[model samples]
Target: MNSVKKIAMLMCIGLPAFVHAGEAMVKWHDFNDYRDVRATNQAKGSYHKQIASSIEKHAIKLAEQLPKGYKLNLEITDVDLAGDVSYRGANEIRVVKPIHFPQLTLNYSLMNETGKEIGKGNDIKLKDMSFMDKIKMGRDESFYYEKRLLTEWFGEEILPKIN
Candidate 1:
């Protein structure tokens, strides 16, 4: 039993090496200065922080597609969520109107393990004017439109440049 325990411990020690993959560093500008990030009527509190956290998490997730030792640094300068704020029955609500669309302005740098820049973009504007026209696989997801916009940008713009 002692020998088996030693083997398990050894395996556990080595697991982290295998689990480490590509990394992403996402930074956000001042939320107060952003274009729009209004919370829905059901939001509890800290709506700005919630949206920032979601965007950061999704950006990191998309960076997983990079090569094992690559790193992506993304700095988001502005954000405008895909809806308009309105009042309904004395409650503030976010209405997904046809005019409102998701927009983001960002800068990014992709670097290899040696810390050499492989690709970079400045003032990259991302706008999804037809955000509502696309079919969504995760309709109930939080920040669905924003996430999709990032995914499309990462896949089409960043991935292509790097590859």
Candidate 2:
């Protein structure tokens, strides 16, 4: 009876370790864009494009940094723009035109080769602040901020939990 109990305990402990021994790979799928900014606005379009591109680049970097022999995959499920607004000023005439900043929400899923979800992260907010400040200063700053956010999220929240 004791031997059977010991065997059950060992199986429970060793099963997951064995399952995790296989190599892991990560890939990114399509991402949703929920921002309401008009495509005609060149500046807004450029900004949005940069954000999307940066996210993809960072995803690849994070995947490469994952521990060896563990397979993982990331799929972008949705991107939700929470809100956006513009400010305009005039002295009986249009001087400084309205500038807009968009708030974004991203949802993603992390899974393994078995089609089982290992972990999922959602509603990660990426806020656009170009409307509040000069483009020269805001553009580079926002890009760096977004990059850092992605790194932290993947390293702290996702990587550790991955087998």
Candidate 3:
């Protein structure tokens, strides 16, 4: 009876480990620039650069958080920017813009180092506020807001697929 109990315990532990070992590993692919906004918008050089930088930073952070065996590939396909200027109280200036955060039509695929796609996250939405928002809110605030939004979105969309 004692031996039987020990065997059952071992099986319970070993089974999960074995299952985990077989799980797929994820390798993220570089984000392909489908449409370069810089080429299109020749006017707002500084603003464009800021937006681009934010998108890249957010993409890299999110990619790093994926599960051990799964990979996410991000690519920026289209970028649309809209600016809204608002007065902050009496003599203040504020710009609330529809930055159209670059719509990154990602080609997410789960695979080993070789190249076989075990799973695919074809279309994922990564949207960020305008550069002014980031500056006003600060990096930490922006990061937290973005992280929460992504977590909620991913949990709803991708998490279901994984489970």
Candidate 4:
């Protein structure tokens, strides 16, 4: 088969699952009040939104585990990314160290197929102190540490409540 035909066939087979996958509702509190969300050298305006997008995307991926008609809602109150920003001669860079672990504070609720809340929490704090020691496949990916932290939390805290 031609390359275009092969690609089209693959997309046709995958589209339904992609469209039907569950998505989480993610909301962020005022970023201005957060502890840390610095993005290398970019201004706060652009980087903050990117950070939120990354988080929301990760949440949606996690939500795919929910059964049909179930939903996960997350309201993030704070975000402290895994690194501290420092200047390296004329350029600014993020320095990753053990002390500067990734942290997230949020509230979450899990709803059932009937729209009833089965599990919920307020001001839940998530942190990865041993982020560097863990095994991660995508080191160059955006928000690598933060996504890892969320993945761990979803599996431990959220998945258990559903079962």
Candidate 5:
């Protein structure tokens, strides 16, 4: 029937619009590291940048998983990354089993495209004690630890809570 064909065409165009109605986007990633410069590592700024990149990546994934028309605004401060090298004597430091925990104070919220607050104060210290998993570290293994924490947090906590 002519009416049935019109209904089918209308459904094809209308369904996707409804399905994507609550989707979100990564509006910004604002990282502020307030660690004392005296206790900072050589790669402090660069390392934090890498962490921000990981957050942006995962936030986008999270946005896709959530409903449509929302945006994520995240501000991370007081970043303390894992591991510390101990000074021995000369311009060198001991690298044996340098273990430390990474922590970041995160302040984040979600807003609709029309500027409605969907969530807030989700202010949390981003840290995962179980990320290491008793794995032996080679040289420069610190790079992956923070990312693992972010990924697991997004998957287990944020993803389910928002969607």
Candidate 6:
């Protein structure tokens, strides 16, 4: 009876791990800017962390939108915000008005419970191409542009298939 008790205890401890092994969720790893020019300032560094956090939260919510055993793996390759700011002088910077277009590149894939690949997308770019034509970006607050871009992408790309 001692051997039986030990076996049962082992199973109880290990069963949950086995079950969660195939659990589905967002697997975002080592997300960082791949562009050659990188920001060195403290503000930009902080902003990048914030951006990553937002993406992680959104990805989790996106995962919950799908059925069980469906995992979405995403890698953010690049991030270019709406506007370009150039230093005009010693203490001033000139903002490029017409070129403030938000863009993001991601390599993503969807996998089922058994690790079967349902779909995949590489070099997927999410960009607001109609920025100059109709909608004018009026706000200059933090994360306004990037949050909008991610929200739109989640709504259009991920929500449809899940629903």
The clash count of every prediction, one per candidate, is 0, 3, 4, 0, 6, 1
Compared with the true structure, all predictions reach lDDT values of 0.83, 0.51, 0.46, 0.87, 0.57, 0.63
Off by over 4 Å in 3: 1-43, 81-94, 97-107, 112-115, 121-151, 160-163
> Would you list the clashing residue pairs of candidate 2?
24-70, 24-71, 25-71
Worst 10 residues of 4 by lDDT: 14-23
Mind giving the per-residue lDDT tens digits that candidate 4 earns over 27-88? 98888899998777888888999998988988998888777777899999999999899999
RMSD of each: 4.0, 13.1, 9.8, 4.1, 7.2, 9.1
State TM-scores per candidate. Answer: 0.83, 0.45, 0.41, 0.85, 0.56, 0.60
For model 1 the local lDDT of residue 69 reads 82
Best-first order by TM-score:
4, 1, 6, 5, 2, 3
TM-score of 5: 0.56
- Deviation in angstroms for 145 in model 6? 2.4
For residues 1-163, write the lDDT of model 2, one tens digit per residue.
Answer: 6999999999999776664443323333333334352322346557567656766666665665554444444444334332233334421211222243434355666655565777766656655455335333334543454455456666677777764
Clashing pairs in 3: 24-69, 25-69, 26-69, 26-70
- State the local distance difference test value for candidate 3: 0.46
Best-to-worst ranking by lDDT: 4, 1, 6, 5, 2, 3
Instruction: Write the number of the candidate with greater TM-score, choosing between 1 and 5.
Output: 1
Query: Which tens-of-lDDT digit does each residue in 54-154 have in candidate 3?
Result: 65565555544444455544443443333233455653232434553423344455443344554566556655554335533434532244344444555
The TM-score leader among the candidates is 4
Which structure among the candidates has the greatest lDDT?
A: 4
Candidate 6: residue pairs that collide: 82-100
Ten-residue stretch with the least lDDT total in model 6: 33-42
RMSD of 2: 13.1
Q: In model 2, where is the ten-residue run with the lowest total lDDT?
A: 90-99
Candidate 5 local lDDT, 104-152, one digit each (tens) = 5667676766778767755677775554565645555344665556556
lDDT of 6 by residue, 88-131 (tens): 55533325355567787888777777778777788888878665
Candidate 5 deviant stretches above 4 angstroms: 1-33, 36-48, 86-99, 134-142
Residue 55 lDDT in candidate 5: 59
| Model 1 Cα lDDT, one tens digit per residue, 78-145 | 88988888889878888887699999999999998788998999999999988888887855877888
